[model samples]
Target: MDNIFGDAAERLFAQTCTPDVIRRAEQGQPSGDAWRACEEAGFADALVLEDHGGAGLGLADALPVVVAAGRHLCPYPIAHTLLARAWLSRVQRPQASGAIALAPQGLAIDDGRVAGTNVAWARSADYVLAGIGGQTWLLPMQAARIEPNGVHGSLDGGVSWALADAERIDHVAPLETLAASAYTGLIAGAMDRVLAMTLDYANQRTQFGKPIGRFQAVQQQISEMAEQVWAARMAAQLAFQGEDGLPRPLLAALGKARASQAVPRVADIAHAVHGAIGVTAEHDLQLYTRRLREWRLAAGSESHWHDRIGADALASRSDALTYLRTALYGKETA
Candidate 1:
C-alpha cells in the first residue's frame, strides 16, 4: 500500500529530529520544541478521528510516525499519545491537549477512585488512559500523585498514585494490539537506525589498513544484524496490516516477540562493531540501542508473547507451520 502519510511523517521527523535535538533531549532537557512541532504537524493526533480534531488515519497509517520517532529516539510518548487519543475518540470523550500516557498494568477503579503504581510517563502526561476490571478510563494527571522514578535512558520512567479519586469512562477497544503494533514499529525503526550506523561504521573504520567490513568476521556480524533488522521490520509491518479495525493479536504477539528477541543480538553486534564508542553518551548509537533494550521489555517481553503464542497454538491444536502461517498472514489454507 502507498502510505503517503507515512512518507510525510518520515520526512517531517527526519527534518526535526536531528542529532543535536536528540542529544539535548537525552540530557534531561524538555523536548517542548520537538513536541510542539509534531503537534503543529498533526502527528500527535494522527490516530484520532477527524471528527475529534485529528487526521482520521488508521492505526496502520499513523504507525510510521511511531517508527520515525523511534529511529530518532524522539523524546515524546508517541505511541501512548496516539493510543490515548484513539480511545478517547472512540468513547466520545473530550480530547485533551498535551502528552498522554497509557497504563497497561497496575490499575484499579473502585468507588469513583483510581489507583495505580508505576504508570508509564504519568509524571509528564496531561492525562492517563488506564484499564481497570476490563473497563477503560481516562483520568486527569492532576488527580494522581506522580513521582519521578528517575530516567531510564530515553524512556520516561515514573510511578503514579497508589490511590486517587477520578471519574471513569467506558471504552473497550483492543488497545493491547494497538500498543503492540506501535511498539513493534518502534523496535523496527531503532533496528533500522542501528543497522545503518553499524554499516556506515564498518565501511568507514579501518583496521590493519583495511575497512573492517572487508573482514569475514565483521562481514558475518553485519549480515546477521541486517537479517534481524529485516525480520523485525517485516514482522512489524505484518502486525500493522490488521484484518479489521483492530490488529490481529497473534500477529502482534509474534511481531513483538520477534522484535524483542532481536534487540539483544542487534545491540550486541552494533556495539561490538562500534567498539567502546557506541556505549558512550556522546555517540548516537547508544540512544537507539538503549531505547531498543527498553522497548523490548515494554508492552510485553519476548517470553510473555512467546507464551501467549504457544498457548494459543496448543489450544487450537495447530501444527507449527499452520500456526506460523496464521500468525503471519491472518488466515488458514485449505
Candidate 2:
C-alpha cells in the first residue's frame, strides 16, 4: 500500500477529525472548515489526473489513505472522493470544488429525478455521484433536500431531487463495486484501530486486582478480535489490487463480503472487552463501531456480496476450491 497519501492523510485527519469534531459534525455542524484543511493538503483530488490538478494516483495507491481515513473515523467522504474524482476526471466532467460523495444501493434516478435513502455523507457533500440508469450522474446538493437520518446529523441522510438538475457525465462501470472496494480498506483500518484500542483497554483495565488482559477469558476474546481485524485487513488488500484505477468485480465482492462479515464480530468483541464504555456516546469506540456497522451495510452488505460470489461460483461450473482460487487470484481453473 502506498503510504505517501496515507501518511499525509493521517496527519491531516488527526487534527481535523478529532472525536469532538466528529461529534459536532454529526449534530449538523458544518464540517466545511475541517474539509478545507483537507483541500489544502490536496487529498480530495489525489486520484484525479495531474492535468486535472490531482496527483494522478490509482485506486490501489489510495488504499492506504482510505485506511488512514478509517483509522480516524473521518466524517467526510474521503473514501468516495478518491474514486469519484478519478472517475469524473476520466469522463471529463467539470471538477467538483468541495467534498463529493458516492451514493450506492437503493438509488432511484429516473425521468430527471434522483433520490436515495441513507446516502452516505449526504448532508455534508457539496456534490454527489450515482449510477443513474447506467449513466454516471453528477448532482449538486444545492437543489436537493437532505433529510437527516441517525442522531449525528448527516452520518447518513435521505435525499431527493424532484427535478433532477444534474449532469449525466458518462456511461461507465457502476460505482457500487469500486465504492465497496475502497470502503473495505476503510473498514480494515477502523477495525485495526478498534483492536488496538481494545487491547490497550484490556491491558490497563484491572479486574480482581490484575489487568483484565491477563485473564484467560479476556485474552481469548482479544485473540479472536485480533484474528478478525487482521483478516479484514487482508480482505481490503486483496480487494484493492488492480491495474488501472478500478478493482476487479469479483475481488471487490470478496473483499467487501469478508470485511463486512468481520464487522459484527469485531464490534461485538470490542464492546464485550470494554464492558460498558464502548457503547457510551462520549467514548470514541462507539464512533468507530457505529461507522463500521453502517459501512458494512453500505455499498453492499456481506449478505449481498456473498450472494453475488456464490452465484458466480455456481455459474462457473467448477469445484468450490477451483472457483475460489480463480476468483481470488484471477487464474484459470483446469
Using TM-score as the measure, the top candidate is 2
Off-target runs (Cα >4 Å) in candidate 1 are: 108-117, 150-154, 162-165, 243-245, 321-334
Candidate 1 — what's its lDDT?
A: 0.76
Question: In model 2, which runs have C-alpha deviations exceeding 4 angstroms?
Answer: 109-112, 150-154, 327-334
User: Across residues 1-334, which tens digit of lDDT does each residue of candidate 1 receive?
Assistant: 2277777777877887787877766565667777788788888888777887888777677767877777876667776787667767777888888887776667765554566645665545667766667876667776666555465544344444434444467656565666777788889988988999999999999999999999999999999999999999887877776632356788888889999999999999999999998888778898888778878887788998889888888887877897777744667666
The candidate that achieves the highest lDDT relative to the unseen native structure: 2
- Which lDDT values do the candidates have, in the order given? 0.76, 0.83
Cα shift from native, residue 95, model 2 (Å): 2.4
TM-score of 2: 0.93
- Candidate 2 lDDT, tens digit per residue, 216-314? 999999999999999998899888877556677889899999999999999999999999988888789998988898889888899999999889888
Clashes of each: 0, 2
Model 1 steric clash pairs: none
